[model samples]
Target: MVKGALLAMGVLGAGMLPAFGPCLAAGLPDTPLDRARVLLVVQELEITLLTHPSATLALEAWCATHHMADRPVVVARKMTLPPADPVPGRVRADLGASATQPIRHRQVQLVCGTHVLSVADNWYVPDRLTAQMNAALDGTDAAFGHVVAPLHFSRDRLEFARLWSPWPGGGQGAGGMITPPAAIVRQRAVLRDTHGRPFSEVVETYTDQTLAFMPAVDADYAH
Candidate 1:
């Protein structure tokens, strides 16, 4: 599990922020205080994820930051495995012919205690994985990261998408407490073995549980 403070990277490139900058700019409350809060929240999210080696590691660190370090398990639920579908054009291009290597597709939810932090879909090249790694993946709910821990895999982030709240052009009124944007942030990346051969492609979605754990901001922050 991750420990101590995070070391964030510069992943959010130019324009992604201003283009989707604080919803306050859209005029909900529209105060300096509200805008600062939104920016702070977005920065926190960026830092938290940017520094982590992988979403799995990020979630583990988040659990530690949130004081759930006592429980070691981070993957709460490993839902049924679905037959791998035709790889996306981008993923196909990323992995090349290796993309056709027998795929093992799985969906899993990472949690800290009872709070589900993120849900992810991992499509991995089974032949690229060791026999032992494949066995663990097939027999248990262990996270792909954990299952392949022995391989000392490293991840390369390829893309990031911030899904805004209330579905493009939705309501923005204050309802209850300081409402943080009910948005989801997604990261798409490939995991490689120690030799740097890409073995898996994963897409992880940070869920509402993330906002619930952090300082709340405007509901329309990214609407």
Candidate 2:
């Protein structure tokens, strides 16, 4: 669990962003103030992810700054056998790869201590990476963003979906406590090299634990 004050990251009283996603209904908080904290933290994190070229580096900063853990975020392999997702024609097009070109698929939990910040799926063209990079990815727990850092990649946002929010429509007449659900947001983006050639496509789902740093809605609001 996250431990520390949110003073370093700050908070918001108003300006709730409307959450949009099919799963929003499943992730709503109880009260208006509870919802406010969720929206505030989610908004800040969304912006944090965009400020850096490498998501791994960006998340490491977030983890440390928020005191989510004693150590920085690390990629934890979520399965014993790698997931076998069927590659689609459109996926190949999105990745700028010809049909039959080799693609590496990895599923991982981006964890800070015991808290999982994001669950990610990466489909990358291994041919574009250095041999050492491929070896590290195949053998170690190095994050996809860090492993390919030498490419000087840029993430091109393709989709930003909010899975939950406490806004104009959700958690309105609430009597429940502020308990955040699992995931708050999801994103799909393509990673491109220095020359702007697409090499990887990823989907990242950020969890409610990102809000774990914030104090309880009732406690903070009471003061």
Q: Pick by lDDT: which candidate is best? A: 2
Best by TM-score: 2
| Each candidate: RMSD | 9.8, 9.6
User: Clashing residue pairs in candidate 1, if any?
Assistant: 23-221
Candidate 2, 1-223: lDDT as tens digits: 2211101111111112222222322334465655666677678888888787777887888888777678776666543432445555555888989888998777676777766677676778889888998899889888888789889889898877787666644534344545445667777789999999998887777776666666543355568
Judge candidate 2 at residue 57 and give its lDDT. Answer: 85
lDDT of 1: 0.60
* lDDT for model 2: 0.67
Clashing pairs in 2: none
Which residue runs does candidate 1 get wrong by more than 4 Å? 1-35, 68-72, 81-84, 98-100, 165-183, 215-223
How many clashes would you count in candidate 2? 0
Q: Give the Cα error of residue 169 in candidate 2, in Å.
A: 6.1
